[model samples]
Target: MARIQIDLPEHFGFSTAIPVYLSHINYSGHVDNALLLTLVTEARVRYFQSLGYTEMDVEGVGIILADAAVQYKSEAFHGEIMDISMTATDFNKYGCDLLWRMRDQVSGREVARGKSGIVFFDYGTHRIAPVPPAFRQLFE
Candidate 1:
């Protein structure tokens, strides 16, 4: 598995934290695997909101996840706060990729690392299109 370190600056963007609860626990009494995806996904939602990118704006040439992968390196216990740092990288004509690093807020240990490919879509025309200048402008 490949891993990379992402430096988060105060003004770069926003960060969201999600707490793991007993409901997210599995039979093993640890954070469930699917729970990790759920937490990371919530972080992505906040990331989009932070960018001021609404679903209406992405209606036609919106973004879609091309690929998503995560590797669990540590276990998060119930009631542990997970800080998910999201940043936009590799922005281009099509879309931008988001890199995320999730760690236990208190211990400061990395629990998982993940990446997702977001693609520009032309939902109206049923074709793939380049990201709109406005959406691209948010990062610039």
Candidate 2:
């Protein structure tokens, strides 16, 4: 069997802190695998908002999460503040990869790292759209 490995970027352009709620913890007394994605989703939204955009509107085009890959590092517990950092990379014609890293705020222990593959879409035509040049330039 092989393990899924995610190579994080050297620097992230955005960062935010989110605390783990009791509901985020599983019976195992650690953050649930599924909930980790929820945390990163929040970070993703903030990342876009910081750039004056949203998941549904990036330079007049909506973004659809094409795929996601997460690599958990350490167990995170309830009440722990997770510091999440993100950046955009791997540009293609229609989309780019959003990479992120999560760590415990107090302990500074890495909790997870991953990337979300995003694709630009046009709601009016219900079709894939080319990446907006202005949006691509922001990360480049």
Candidate 3:
């Protein structure tokens, strides 16, 4: 069997702390696999907001999640604050990979690492849009 490996960057451009709630836990007493993605989604929103953009509008175009991958390193329990850090890399014609890592805020133990594929879209034209130059410049 093979496992998914996520190579994180040395430095992250954005980070936010999100606490695990009871609802985020599963029957086994750890953060649910699905909800982990939710935590990442929250961090993603804040990342965009920090840049003064929203998921629906980034440099005059919207963004969509093309794909995602997660590699869990440890379990996260309720009430524990998770520090998620993120950065954009692996740019293409219409999208780029948003890489992230999650760690326990107190112990600094890594919980998970992953990347989400984001694609720019034009709502009016109903087609994939080119990565906005202004948006690309921010990370370059």
Best by lDDT: 3
TM-score per candidate = 0.81, 0.97, 0.98
Q: Candidate 3, residues 94-115: lDDT per residue as tens digits? A: 9999999999999999999999
Q: What local distance difference test score does each model get?
A: 0.77, 0.95, 0.97
Candidate 2, lDDT over the whole model: 0.95
Q: What tens digits encode model 2's per-residue C-alpha lDDT throughout 1-140?
A: 88889998888999999999998999999999999999999999999999999989988999999999999999999999999999999999999999999999999999999989999999989999999999999987
Tell me the spans in candidate 2 whose CA falls farther than 4 Å from its real position. none
Backbone clashes for every candidate come to 0, 0, 0
lDDT of 1: 0.77
Candidate 1, residues 44-115: lDDT per residue as tens digits?
A: 888887776653355345677888767778888899999998877778778777788888999999888777
Worst 10 residues of 1 by lDDT: 4-13
Rank candidates by lDDT, best first: 3, 2, 1
